[model samples]
Target: MSAIPQERRLVTAVPGPKSQELQSRRTASVAGGVGSVLPVFAAKADGGIVEDVDGNRFIDFGSGIAVTTVGASAEAVVRRASAQLADFTHTCFMVTPYEGYVAVAEALAELTPGDHAKKSALFNSGAEAVENAVKIARSYTKRQAVVVFDHGYHGRTNLTMALTSKNMPYKHGFGPFAPEVYRVPVAYGYRWPTGPDNCGPEAAEQAIDHIAKQIGAENVAAIIIEPVLGEGGFIEPAKGFLPAIAQYAKDNGIVFVADEIQSGFCRTGQWFACEDEGIVPDLITTAKGIAGGLPLSAVTGRAEIMDAAHGGGLGGTYGGNPVACAGALGAIETMKELDLNARAKRIEAVMKPRLAAMQEKFEAIGDVRGRGAMLAVELVKDRTTKEPDPQATAKVAKACHEAGLLVLTTGTYSNVVRFLPPLVIGEDLLNDGLDVLEEAFAAL
Candidate 1:
């Protein structure tokens, strides 16, 4: 890892000479389909700081898109993974099996929502976990259709793209998607046609009724949704909305799968966002924070539902690699030892107020919402109209990035500025990042 302090220090500029050189090389080698949010190339990242190839350091508010909740290069994770690396790399659980994979499954079964007897199957990414979760639901329910909410983002795979709601970047030109996937309205408080007060029940009724009338609930395999929509702007569904949907799925015998990939692993001040509403989803898909930046994802659910899949029905070559499993165990240990959940709540306590203050000053900040460290501000062209201002949002994000703060933008409309600082980030550094955000707004 590069030698750098926790403080944000810029040597030459945002994307310095070294990063620029690497960017030019990337243009020649990397494909156009892959997007780089910022041109800065990272050499090392620890805690809340990412040291670029140019030796300039930035306070990371993206957490590698919510992958490094325990912080990139967390000591526990590195140590454990190192030990596993020295011992052995891959045995392929199906081929010979390993204790690490079983241990991770045990940990996931305990950590994921619900007290009911639960089981888990490991995978390589959030998209794969969601794909397997859908498989499990279908095998258990004997159904073909999968229901996803408006603005909900699943993944980039064909099946997941079919489940995803966005088109421009995620689904556009991707073409002929998988079959039997349905999309419905989400209880997005800010954008609801009626007021937020009416969003919860109304959206739930609309979605449930649509399924009942159009797809026939009996044919629905699962209802998959992000507890707090990640890529689609950190829109936390209106209160009672999630529980109502879960209940409706329960009544209909449809598997309710909570895609807590970005919101799980203590990112939302709770182990999983579904726990905020005491929701015990039939299956929960997790990935981003599960292995402290290592590529690990899981589909944990009620034993009966999970066991419905036959032997050899799930898993990939790299699924639950021993080293990654070790990293997950270490990350889980770190979360418990440091009480990162409390730290996450503390982060929200510090950030939401600052963002609200910004909202008071900037009319473009039409809405400030989200929970714990995963918060965001929806940018709009008009307060009452709530017309998305993607241009202005991009401008402010560029300003922040140029100034050394790594804030991310999201939303179906591409007009939400998000803050996802690491849970282990010091209060001072968190404040500094927020200060940069404040300046970005002032510039706008």
Candidate 2:
């Protein structure tokens, strides 16, 4: 059905002459701060394959960092977005509101967790949505302090950088970040100090205690966390952790915000990862996989909290662009039509076992974890010590790229090789990508 061939094909060496030429051009034009995972320039992409300028077709395991759940060139997305584009490009949602924007808001209200009356406001990126969510929470609760977890990545913006834990690339040199942001411990099972068994209750109690004593829970506006930590090595917080935190927020009148940017919209075997624990957030920020590669993010939450912000308080010039809204609607349609949640579960079923088997053979693999297509393997220098092996992570990623499999490396320690294959990726292609990974590990 798709025009682009699904099979991987390598007509030339990875990053061949053409891509090398492009790289030279990019170096001259693009900013040095902007980094790319791979140097292979894409000529075409569809399903699970990205054909490069040099005729090397690589299996896409990163899904453009979990943005394309329904594939890059999904038919419904193209059709609806093209039709909307032909009709009108932009009037700006604020000046002249359109049905597409409202339609998308309606869809988000119905899809996101919670049966309560909900409302949504759209934005250009996840950072904008998160920033806006914080604004709304502050306005509603009349509080200033916000709580975030360690190893949780909200975005690149100043406030989000302060909320984020990583210091090297994210927060390095980006000084004088926004004030009133508090950091707390996340129930990271693999690296929890007291061990995984007590991680949930112990970490939650410590985090709550610190917030109550240090920041004064009464002054806290919000407690934001990723349901499944993304750039932090796909770490799923230990069981009972989220619920405990949510309850604490509720009791303290603090807004419980779930940053579902990378884990929402069927990428995590459910509509939202927060649903896995039946934890209902006061506000949920979503972006990455919402619009089939188009830039669109939203802050969906309780109607009362959302309405706390004045009419003119929330919105940007390009927020909720019609074309992006159409893409989102199309993406939602594709998800329901294709049953992508089930597909994500199936991906997990296939990937986790293989990763576990790899761990059995390879002592360097400290942990294999993640839900659905959002999976990862944390590399370590020694299994006993669990010391991060960022060098091995880099080596394995480079090997995968050379073999025409696109994978991504992440984590606070930079020792996590994360897999975020498109939900539409065929099983054969998925296995091929994993095969490339196994070979990389073996060679390492």
Candidate 3:
């Protein structure tokens, strides 16, 4: 049986009676530091639709920040996790290792797009995965300094924040960040030192030369990057960029870490986005969609590097929760059975034309970029000037929300509208969501 209810209902306003009541209670009880996106509370979700407490059903384009690739409330994930609940929940892998944890790790080792011997470690979030990957790289290389690219986002943890480049929201006053983290320019074609249309091997060469000259690669432990940058604006490095970086890291004895937290698990038309360029990173950090909406993350990489850390030093209290592992098993099986990679390609096919047409029609659209289901439309004042139109972007986002669609806006400038629909969405519903976007643009 489908996990969603038979019908959707919206008897009152979008926030309606129940949501407003909850909002009042939230204001009273919750800490002021907590923030919210849409005011509507989630009642249930399935396929690519989120039903709010007031019964408003909206087409989901964000996919819970790209975490529910198998769709929220996927049947297989629910069933597997429910069955595993009958077995047990937490054993704290450090205290006592469990088969479920090992099983999930084994799956990751096999599936993370590498023929080399690999080992896997599980954690609760992308931040944890990134931290652990850093730990592994530093331990294996016995180096102190790490190099990150400009506009890259690792996570929100203090160490990851140091690894992250943006400062306003993520690092605003969160001073005393971790030490030995260096940031350099990313090969972002849109705003690179060189022009957009000039992205090629030369761009990669320039960045690498700067890194070598400035950081003196010998002191760097790892060069962590996103195969396709996520919060930095869905920017894909040029054709020769990833390979060049990988080769540079290899020659310098620096671990090449692929932060696939937002680009793995078939979200980018492949098992991992780096695979598109045949770049096999020494370490890969992944989360978001790994467990079909469950809180699970993993760091998979060369067995030697992963094993460099001491045994008791690696796991957390809830590192590989049994339920999340079961969910992951089901999620991976669902991906294989459904061919979500092919689905992502199909989504790209639909989104590219629609977004390209919008770029032609709207003066605010500066760029249409990204891969597969992971796509974005960058907003600007004028195509030629490329001044960010944050106000117009906010208006369009609000319009889409009011019109029964859940679109997400992101970017270093907060002016890019990103689309991350669940891979399971029907093409017709997907098209309808795109049409809503068009209406939003028109209203803006």
Which numbered prediction scores highest in TM-score against the true structure?
2
Ranking by TM-score: 2, 1, 3
Predicted structure 1, TM vs. truth: 0.99
> Where does candidate 1 stray beyond 4 Å?
1-3
Show model 3 residue runs off by greater than 4 Å. Answer: 5-11
TM-score, every prediction: 0.99, 0.99, 0.97
lDDT of each: 0.92, 0.94, 0.89
Comparison by TM-score, 1 against 3, better one: 1
**lDDT tens digits, residue span 130-168, model 1:** 999999999999999999999999999999999999898
- What does the lDDT come to for candidate 1? 0.92
lDDT of 1 at 340: 95
lDDT per residue (tens digit) for residues 199-277 in model 3: 7576777778777788788889999999999998898987878898899999999999999999999998999999999
lDDT at position 12, candidate 2 = 80
